[model samples]
Target: MQDSDSLRGFLFDNMPIRGQIVTLTSSYQEVLKRHEYPSNIACLLGEFLAAASLLGATLKQSARIILQARGSGALKTVMAECASDNRVRGIARGDFKVCATQTGFKDLFVDAVLAITIEPLQGQRYQGIVPLEGDNLSQCLMGYFAQSEQLPTSIKLAASTQESAGILVQQLPNHAPLEQSTTDWQTINLLIKTLRAKEQLHLTHNDQLYLLFKEHHVRLFDAKDMRFQCHCSRHRTARALISLGEPEIREIYLQQELIDMQCEFCGALYSFKKPFIDALLRDQNKALR
Candidate 1:
């Protein structure tokens, strides 16, 4: 079986096509434990987590990649992010009700928009939004790449109760001439098409890649660890409380006797009692002077 919380990247020796495979187990379970998600929603979030990790690997600089889907149907919004450090977190919100029949991507997310945002630690952020038109999340991502990136990309995603896994293949910019590139892309695409969700979840990374690309010249890289980490801390929460301004802070403190907050991404709790609130207000006032 594939190791949990690891991502593997590979490349073809003679072609410009590259690929990444990620399997999230402990990390996926950690995110799911924060909320009681329906089976369908949990599966979608798992796919998003894998996708975000795959995209984060492509970042040459320090940055975080966020994958979000907003829809008008039962599923309202789903969010996932993966930092350059391989820290991953995700959550989903919806007006969902479980049904006897299975729900497809289109059924749960009608008239949806899929957005991918890149936030660099030092530079301006970039975002691409596209229509969510597909039977599954993988197909929707393919459409996103086709419209927003104009890249020949293929993705396969699978989520079980215990783990989530995904694989992505893309044709790089520099390759042989257009005709040769097309032929190469087609061949790689066909090979990838043979992969199934069960195989992705059941096989080890090396075994899976070898099964798919053993006939070709491929080099696999060492796996990078991916983990469920929430960057939330009391210091950050204090800064956020200060941003709320003294009046709002005072109002909340007066009404509740304390300001309590919880990190939605993780179940960490932060509380500012009266004395803490007063100290924060004093600090803010002193900074204003």
Candidate 2:
């Protein structure tokens, strides 16, 4: 049986190629439970979550990676975040009724742009943006790597309400002859193309890889657990409110006498009374001085 909520990295023993496979079951369900998304939107969000996990595995340091897309169509925005620790969270905002009827990526996200951001624990943050020019998420991500990283990468993604799964294969720089490297990469790409969405969602990592690369010497590492953990807290929420400035805070307080903040990813709610807001503002003022 396929492992649920886990990611595994594998390598081709004979070539400078590496791959990662990720499956999201419980984590995907958790995101769905937090919001009432339509079937199509839910599936798209699942793909984003799975993609984030695969990309997160490639990080060489402690960091967080976010995949976000904004558009003018039925699907207004979708974002997913994954940390080096394998924690994941995602959200989607849009016209659900209209999104439900839209299936193609282009139709669902007209004039959309996808952004990939990497934030390390102690380093500069980087982001890469690409216009949504492909038929699906996998193609768009492949375009990102081709344009930004200059690496030959192929990605396959599949998602349903029940689960989400993705596979990413990338060719690393090798000292081998160019012809040999290109041949090896092309061979692997052809094999990966045989993978179907139903197979990705249903097959175990070992079974899937072996089925695709049984002829090649493939080494798959131990599975790492993936989870749905929102990085939201009262402190972070308070910081965000402070960024809104005192004037905006006071106006909101005047209308409700209390300020309420809810995390879009986890739906956790935090409320602040006038006194707490006053203290926070005082602290901000002191810091400015």
Candidate 3:
């Protein structure tokens, strides 16, 4: 791999808080493997990929987190999803060719939303969509933590063809995770706001926090590997095709000789002939017995 990657969590033993730093290298290139995304949108995917990884690590249960930006701009939407297994994937929609020429944060995002969705393997899923805040993905996520979780959280993320990195700093809730107050959270958030892109992406996990809080004590934890993997297959595609309803499948069959579905994450294609479709339906019927 040209770009080695890692995910490390740190604990501030005496501060009543903990956080994570996520880094990616070739894995980012893997995201751009099959598509030609404009530089800005490519960077957006990387930022969201790092954000999703950081958020997924906070979950105690087996969960996946999806970070998405959606709006009416030339670049209509982009999404990144991270699984419990550390498998990551992302894609952008429409014309993702916009460039940011302004200096201010709000000038960058214009109109959009930062949506976080948590899906547990064996439980009901939940989603929260908040209006876009700040100029970039990091600030938008930090804004989310402030408004929704009130955790005094801050995030800084960077993306390039070679790598993607993100740093997260959040104060522990005064009460349980569910009962923390929004007032004190805002006060402590000021400290987190001091992070810069260079420090977040350049420093080591240990050094990053040490540099940020030289006056405080912090505990470091084991790191995990993060990589790119596509979770799509012919079987999955067949299952999805079955859900399309007979009418829809017939419509596809009418215009196309074979149904060829491609996986956006990995660029793998799954094509099904009419016979294969019939066999799938038969197998599905047999399995339902």
Candidate 4:
């Protein structure tokens, strides 16, 4: 429902916690063009992609958040990354299908975990994996906040080839600075729990917040830019090929004529021929010496 391609943040002046929502359109479409993802998998990936965007906003430093789904079923995995500066990219693996009118947490994902990774611009990556507690991505996220963070959090996420959108609500501590209006966290949590997924997908950020917190003072920040970008190239792929070992490279070259490596992130193909592969291997060995 948003016309802009940016992640937005909002706060209840009298509430204990703040929330973020981000919708990606052009960014989501770019990822879809890189591969022919199954419709249901694409939707799953889109939801996680938007979640990563919101998660990235919660960091205090230059960081990247990756929302990943690993399952033992048809959809092997889906991952999306959003960086401190709002760069967005994602990919989905495996062919997945869904047939349900009103699905629950267990119906769609089956056996899966929602893993969140926080990688700072210059620090060790911190990751947290929570079971897919609900059929919907939002329920799984809510469970994470309630259990891991102990903060009451609610989320709604959606996406298609055309666009991706989401909304999040959180209950902050009473001691937080934003609680001047003195509304109890429990009161706000109840209000947030009433937000339906359909309403979130159809409403604008301001309108949605106004609907819930009309009686309280709220602060909304300007939207942060979001885009599609992949940090991979021929050189990186070539380095990966070099790491595969000279004998391995030679075996493929002597028989197959080309060593082909497909980048899952961008769907780019990196191919090495006999001479090029040999030269790369020699360079690697020389560097090792």
Best by lDDT: 2
Compared with the true structure, all predictions reach lDDT values of 0.87, 0.93, 0.76, 0.76
* Worst 10 contiguous positions by lDDT, candidate 1: 95-104
| Model 1 TM-score relative to the real fold | 0.90
lDDT by residue (199-285, candidate 1, tens digit) is: 899899988888998888998899999999998899898888788877887788667887778888998999878898788778778
Tens digits of per-residue lDDT for model 2, 95-187: 899898887788999899999999999999999998988989998999988889667899999999999999999999989999999999999
Q: How high is the lDDT of residue 167 in model 4?
A: 77
Over the stretch 185-229, how does candidate 4's per-residue lDDT look in tens digits? 667767776776556666787887888878889898988888888
Q: Please count the clashing residue pairs in each candidate, in the order shown.
A: 0, 0, 0, 5
Q: Which ranges of candidate 4 are over 4 A from the true structure?
A: 97-108, 172-183, 243-246, 274-289
**Which pairs clash inside model 1?**
none
Candidate 1 vs candidate 4: the lDDT winner is 1
User: Which portions of model 2 miss their true places by more than 4 Å?
Assistant: none
Report the error of model 3 at residue 122, Å.
1.1
**TM-scores, all models, native as reference:** 0.90, 0.97, 0.84, 0.84
Higher lDDT: candidate 2 or 3? 2
lDDT of 3 by residue, 172-202 (tens): 7554443344443443355556767666566
Q: Which residue pairs show collisions in model 3?
A: none
Top TM-score model: 2
